[model samples]
Target: MSLFNKALASIGIGSAQVDTKLEKDKVTPGGEIRGVVHIKGGNTEQKVDEIYLGLNTTYLKESNDRKINVPVVIDRFRLNEPFTIGPGETKEIPFSFVLPLDVPISIGRTKIWVSTALDIKNAVDPSDKDYLHVIPNRLMDAVLNGVEDLGFRLREADCEQAPYRLRKRLPFIQEFEFVPVMGSFRGRLDELELVFFQVSENETEIYMQVDRRARGLGGFLSEALEMDESNIRFTVTSSDIPGLRQKLETIINKYS
Candidate 1:
């Protein structure tokens, strides 16, 4: 009977199961995430080799002139060591980690989740998944507010395949698109795209692409050739928020 149960467990008929419970489902970048992993033993004794938790998100990749969604593991953590569980036994492990500062917010088509896996030697492993909603950090929030203060409204936001020059640890980047509704450059600019490069508690680096409104035949030609856009790189600190609108205005004027 024991041999039969072990065989069944090995084949996943009655293998151990795993479930993760998070303290909170919503968090901000550079924040801590706390969770617990619950494991229940199967019908027979099993030797658990290790347990792992991974942060997962999707990114776009171009292939054959088509965009394909690909899964990326941003970070991972090993939670436990080898252990033994008897039939019907249960165990719980608590975990906590700080999310990366540049993690993209959960907006639009972008999604982020945590996955937990139980590894059993020569047996089927069970796993659990928990999704999370990531919000902007303080610095990022300030920057966004500054943009709004400059009379630009957020038009769209999404995570897409990063350009070569901007590629870092991840293969994708989050873009915040905005258009001036009632600003000095409202009539001169078509749209503005902002991408955060590095974000910290005190400072952040930003990349701005300013699209100028087309004028005549030359302007139309430049637009078709991607020459109508100008890219600018700048860094700002917490103290810069107060004058951010004016600073951005000056930058846009230069490009316009």
Candidate 2:
């Protein structure tokens, strides 16, 4: 028996096993996830009371000057009928569900983890977890276009704890970074970090942080801005290209 099987055997109920298989290994938000749940009976025939699927993720929380692991449940599904399995009988269950577009993408690959388990009376058997990657749709493209048009290039992207409580409903934030195109300011700004929330068909909330580097004489200057359920993501426009270029010269004249 495998280590997992041994662990399950130690629980004292008849040994049970669970397996999960997904139809599409990759998907985008607003996509559907379809899979099968396989269950095997143990030494004795058992009354399989129920089965369930959990969409879970690990998030970070900061308090007391430190961060801690926090598990969040995005959604859950349960079987309504009780089935009986003969000794050593194998059973398969089918499942499919649509993923919410706003769901946070995993650290790397929008791939979220889905865990499935079975219940035999009070005994529980958990299957090995599966990872499914998600993609962002057209809405994401529209948002990115605005940023790129504003002289920012994609630098870094990741899911992290929201820095503030301004948006209470979202558990994770995606940060995108961009550098000022050549000759944009007095000194080159490091990069801009962006966060999006309340994403939908019509509008999305945007949060921006500008990282301005300090030079010889001037105090460091930086600004943070937030937008709630609005599409005002771009402040500088194409028409401002000429004036924006001039502003960079002044920055150099003043400092460097």
Candidate 3:
């Protein structure tokens, strides 16, 4: 029966199971994430060659003219070196990491998660997954509030594969789409799209694409050809928080 039990364990019939418990799932960009990895040995002793964790998310990529969701790892690290656990044994390993500054905010279908897996030789490895609710940090929150205060409502947000020129540390960019609701630009603009770039704790760069509302035949032609839009790039810092709305108004009104 020992040989049969070993065979079963080798095929993961009874192997180590991994579970990760986070200190808090609600996180901010560029924040600290604390957690513990609990490993429970099953019916037989197992040798774990490696243990790793990854901060992961998905972005939309276009392939053959069709959009497909692709999983990406923002950051990953190994928990410890090789180890072993006996049958019915439990091990608790604590971990901590700072979330990347460019991690996508969990809006729409943009989900960020942590994946933990154990590498077992000649066996099916066990793994665990936990989702994270990534919220805007202080500076980002201010930018969102300022935009809303300017009378634009958020339409949608998505993490899409970025163009080569606009690619930052990651291959994806998180875009915020907004439609004018009750602002001065409500009549002058069709929609305003904002993409944050080079985000950090203190400041961030923003790329704004202002699509102007078509007026006449010339405007219609230009719009149809994607020529009626204005692109503006700027940087916002913590010191700009107090006058952010006015600054944004000044910049947006110029092109509106």
Candidate 4:
């Protein structure tokens, strides 16, 4: 059964229906979101105190308990109060809100739901939840472009379930995995993982881990293998986006 029907059945208001509409299907970070909520009274007269619109994001929590159902509030709106409508009364309320600039997105594609609800005190009703995919902003896109330009292909992406500290307050952290082009990395590295930590308004720290390939030598050949690898920490911090890409390429060349 539909959420509308379930809510109606739960509240004994088999006559009311709710619908929500959005101006755009996709919203950019730090952009405007505009939408309208529609509510119709069912077979009988009903008293509605107010209607509300909420922008929410939900994710799963992984811990000792390992349970799901995590919802965070992004924005909210309230409609008129103490409205009385006879049988079959239809009402539409318009709402607009600003998306926060620092709202975090999952590493890859992620679906987010926005809810618009009509609250008739003591009435059975369900809030409408609409799904949208959150895409990365230009700053992040630039970084990805730089990485690809350096001949690194995306391998995988994921988010950390535990709270990780970054310079920013965003509760989630995203990791991008990549494999360097042939002859780019030396020693026996199989893959490289790049994790971005936004430390401040203008600074980002790119943390990297190299997974080394197994060695056949007897005396820790991998540890003994010494190639002049350009330190990425120094390179990325001193360079612009393009400069960072160049530095990364240089590091890969030197390591290879």
Give the best candidate by TM-score: 3
| Weakest lDDT window of 10 consecutive positions for candidate 2 | 222-231
lDDT of 1 by residue, 85-125 (tens): 88999999999999988788898788999999988987878
Q: Each model's TM-score, in the order given?
A: 0.94, 0.69, 0.97, 0.67
Give the lowest summed-lDDT range of ten residues in model 4: 226-235
> Model 3 over residues 9-88: C-alpha lDDT tens digits?
88889888999999999998889999999999988888899899999999999999999999999999799989999989
Among these predicted structures, which one has the highest lDDT?
A: 3
Error of 4 at 110 (Å): 2.2
Please report how far candidate 1 places residue 253 from its true position, in Å. Answer: 2.2
Point out where model 2 deviates above 4 Å.
Answer: 1-14, 107-111, 145-155, 168-170, 179-188, 201-203, 215-218, 221-256
lDDT of 4 by residue, 119-186 (tens): 66666655778875556555556667776776667887765443544334544545677776744453
